[model samples]
Target: MARVIALVIVLPVRLVWDALGYCLKQLWRWVLAPIGRALGWLIHHLIVIPLRFLWEWVFVPVGRALWWVIDLLVVTPLKWLWGWVLFPVLKALWWVVDLLVVTPLGWLWRYVLAPVGRAVGAALAWAWDVAGRISRAVGRALGWVLWNLIGRPLAWTYRVILTPVGHWLRTWVWAPVASVARAVRAAAREVRVALFGGPR
Candidate 1:
């Protein structure tokens, strides 16, 4: 009876557990693992390997060839032309400019312009000196004429007429007026003292 009960309980439990474990194993093998492997293969072959090949062979070589062509066709020719043609032409132009323009200007400045400037400056200085002498002579003549005509007459008049008149007025008229003012002030002081009975 005990063996029959144990078999009835344990057998069903073991069977259920085994069924679940087998299902899990089958699901992993058929679904998850295959998906992971497919993804890895796709990435390696399509994206990574192709990019590596393109970089190593196609892109690098093409870039190098393009640079080589640019140097051969453009840079080398431009450098050669500049060295052979443009450099010589520019040097010749500089020589011509120095000969035609610069040398002539230097000669003109040395021979023609310098002498003319010196002559002009000397003439101006001479004229200025003559003008200054003439001006001084004129000023002296005017001063002498003014002294004789106006200043001397005014001085004579002041000495002869004004001095005596001013002295006479000061002696007669001013002295009398000052004496009368002093007398009037003395009388006012006496009247104030008698009325107010104090100095003020």
Candidate 2:
């Protein structure tokens, strides 16, 4: 008797689900049928009719006429201008520029600058020889005094104090600075100097 009652309850639920599924299927078919017919009609009328008309009435004769006009007006004129006018004009200009600038520049660089450069180099060589002798004498005198008086002690002090300070200054204190910030700082300094009259 409990099995019979359970089967009765499940039968009604199954029937209700089947009815809902049928209604949804019928509604979808009804909605899509009209849209499919309309699309078929549009494909027949809009696409087929215009394509046939273009092929039969417009395309062939227009294409031939365009080809002929382009051959006459565009292609012929371009060929004539390139062959007769443009090439010769560009070549002539190139030749003129070669004569005026390039040839003279080559001669000047080769002959004129070569001799003048040799003369100036000889004078500089002589000056450097004289300066080298004088600098050697001065350096010897300074070296004698430093070795006798200040060399060892001063070197020791610098090694103790300045090496670490120089490293710290380079790595942490002084660095690559932005140009805009530098400019702003300089402007501020100038304004302060003008306002305060620069350290009395």
Candidate 3:
């Protein structure tokens, strides 16, 4: 009795629940799925494709044109300033510096300082040679005067007069002194032997 009653109660509820699940599944598969696919296709074609095309074609070309305008107006003028105006001005300044400062200094060094220095050196060398010659001549004159005046007289006195005088003194005075000394020594020996013994 209880089993029949439970079946009668649960059977309609389970059938209704199954039917609702089938309807929901079919709606999702047929209606909602196709609508979602269509929405995706429309968003891709209308919004995404148009935006990509606009970015590639319109916006990119406009940006390139703006860049070209800036390059032409601003950058080209700056290039011309450096190339045509400022570069030539700097070159002219370098030329002026070379002309006024460098050229004169080079000329002064090459012409004035070099020649003057060479002339001064030559004059000094010539003066040195003349002074050396004068000194040599004075020395020769002094040597000639000394040899004739003092050295010749001294040589003559030593050779002729002093040599004979020294020989005469040695023969006369030295011989007598040596003889007297020998005689005295012999007499003293004889007296010493007479006072002491003959041999000890």
Candidate 4:
């Protein structure tokens, strides 16, 4: 019974809330429609119409007239004047370019190359001298070490380690292979002489 009562109360409240929402929406549209119409009228009559007129009547013809006058008065005269007055000016400019840009660049090359070449030459000479000194020192040190400390011991070590291996290979592997190769060669020569009527 309590649940049924609660449901009945909630249903009427929902109905009232929906009716209020619909009424508020209708009222808002009714109020804003006139304001929107007025704003449209204001923009069309005041802003857009004047802007269109200014663009069509003032901006286009004035810009065209200005361009025509500039072409006739300024650009055409300057073009002609360029031939008359600009020749000497261009010659002067060329001379200036030769003096300022080319000559200075030539001088810069001489100035820079001489000093830089000299410095590089000096540096290379110094480097070569230092390298020679270092090489001599290292060579002397290595020679002394080999003569005094390592040469005899290294020779003894080589003899002890390698002599037996060398002897064994010379006796076993080298001797047998050499003998077999010689025998094969002799038989090949005999067969060739028998077939080809004596050796060449």
Best by lDDT: 1
Give lDDT: candidate 4, residue 170: 99
TM-score of each: 0.58, 0.52, 0.41, 0.44
- In candidate 2, the residue pairs with backbone N, CA or C atoms under 3 Å apart (3 or more residues apart, or in different chains) clash, namely none
- The stretch of ten residues in a row with the least summed lDDT in candidate 2 is 171-180
Candidate 1 lDDT over 8-44, as tens digits, reads 9999999999999999999999998999999999999
TM-score, structure 4 vs. true: 0.44
Error of 2 at 152 (Å): 12
Off by over 4 Å in 4: 2-5, 77-88, 95-127, 130-200
Backbone clashes in model 1, listed as residue pairs:
none
Task: Output candidate 3 Cα RMSD.
Answer: 27.1
Best by TM-score: 1
Local accuracy of candidate 3 as per-residue lDDT tens digits, 1-200: 99999999999999999999999999999999999999999999999999999999999999999999999999999999999999999999999999999999999999999999999999999999999999999999999999899999999999999988888888998888888989999888889888985676
Please give the TM-score that candidate 1 achieves against the real structure. Answer: 0.58
| Cand. 2 Cα-lDDT | 0.91
Say which prediction, candidate 3 or candidate 4, comes out ahead on lDDT: 3
